[model samples]
Target: MHGHGYGQPVKQPPHTAWLVFLRVLFVALGILTIGFLTWAMMLRLAAVTRRSLDWGLFVAVLAADILSITLVAIEPGDEIHTTGGYVGILLLLCTLVGTIAYYLAADIRHFLLQQQAYEAQRTAPAYGYPAPAAPYGATTVPTIPTVPTAPGAPGMPSASGPHTPPPMPHARVPQPPQPPLTTPPPQRPAPARIDQVRAELDELSDYLRKQDGPEGGR
Candidate 1:
């Protein structure tokens, strides 16, 4: 049968030397921000603090780098050298650098805080009293006392017999009465008159004439 134990093979690291080389290649290809980000990530992994500001700064830096790279890649020629393009590229680079710097500063701050906390813990008084030394002697096992039961007398139910619960009363619920069915009375058709039809036609003609007058005026 299969079982779990600490007998499994050693797992490899998530990032290898080849990955590191590729990251270095990316850095050499004018993506210094990415390299800085990689270093920051390593620091975060090593350190205890996981601050939200640090994560936000990393995302901002990555976005700025991606934007700058996209702009440069799309307009490779003299367009990047133009005033507006140059300014945009410069601003993006500045944003990338600024975010990286902010993240590093936060990391430093967290590191200092952690160090200070560690020092405080090391210097703090030991309030825990040493547990009283376990008695150094032979121990006696505890013994439980036996309880004596009284003898059952005359015709009453014996205590040794299993108990049976009484049957519960069943209740009957009343249902609502159904409505009675009935047939509706038949409807009669009204008789048509030529005078009524002539009046309706006259009204429709007047409405049409009024609508046409507004359109004709327009």
Candidate 2:
């Protein structure tokens, strides 16, 4: 975000436990200016840099070193050697300046912004109780809470109305079963010709008796 249209820097490194420990170690060792280079090498090995290694801070270091050496050599009666204390002092000073500038770079600022947004989103949890809704005959639309997100990321939009739990199904009130009905047994139907049939049967028996008692039986 430093005015012009420069692309974003390398993505932030993963937040693994070991990486976090190493970051803390390198930060402490940064006092001597070697830690920056070491960390840069690690990032390079991890292929995290998109544009420049060490976030282009090494350029400042190089420019400063050359300028310091040239100024020192130009002085009268000064014989500059690679092993001289002047060279070491100059490199350390340049590295320190480069480190400062690196922290102040546009890419670093953007990264820090992203980090803060991520932290804010994480600290404010997403799984809290749903926003409370107004009861029956409510006057206002209840404020439905939503999760927060970092800039440029997907965001949670509040619901048009408050969230309410679904109504529970009504339990069936089971009734005790009723006893079966009882009735008198039905009567047998009376026969229509029973008395007439009995009279005919008696007349036939009398005819048989008269035939057996004939007086003229030869």
Candidate 3:
């Protein structure tokens, strides 16, 4: 990070959001890694810093990513000879390996730098004068007041090891009584049956016999 100033550079605060953003960028980079590498090889090859291993690793990662992209784009069998295809595939594999190597190297470098900074802070001693001891062995120890403990106080346990918990009261919850089950009466037919018709005919025949007997008496 750079600031618009002629004075001392200010240390930027670390943002977790930036790390999340970088992760998203890295995913996007994966898709265009090889393309970026090839572009760098063509135009920005000289831009790669030769001063430090970290810079070299950075360049290598870029190159590998670009090469991987290029290799992926090349379709071996389509319009190209078998030999060319095989060569392209081999180059692609090598580029992919380089991509992985560079990525790991960059991560390791960053982690080491962070760890070094942490260690530096840890090892750095504090600069200040120490407090003088109580006037050459003339000790002055502060007295702590004694507090009386109750029989069953929170901090102090009882004389009988520990206090037992009081027994829980028994509660009988009333449940609703179940209703008795009764079978339903069968449904009768709407129309008369053959047995009902036979009973009616027998009653009619008895009535006709009674009428005949009354007529004979007359």
The best candidate by TM-score is 1
Model 1 agreement with the true structure over 91-160: per-residue lDDT tens digits: 5657645544554455456545665655554565323433345588968678997444443655455467
Put down candidate 2 lDDT per residue, 1-218, tens digits, no spaces.
56444433334435556554654554455555442343343333233334575545445544555555555555556455545546655665656555544533533444566667666555653334344566989798579976655444445433444446799999999999998897978965556466667778888888887787794474
Where model 3 places Cα greater than 4 Å from the true spot, the runs are: 1-13, 32-51, 57-80, 115-218
Clashes of 3: 6
State every prediction's TM-score relative to the real structure. Answer: 0.36, 0.27, 0.31
Ranking by lDDT: 1, 3, 2
- CA lDDT of each candidate? 0.55, 0.53, 0.53
Q: Rank the candidates by TM-score, best first.
A: 1, 3, 2
| Clash statistics: count for each candidate | 0, 0, 6
CA shift at 207, candidate 3, in angstroms?
99
1 or 3, greater by TM-score: 1
Query: Clash number for model 1?
Result: 0
**Residue ranges of candidate 1 with Cα displaced over 4 Å:** 1-48, 125-218
lDDT of 3 by residue, 82-143 (tens): 55455555665565455444544544455456556655545653234233456786979799
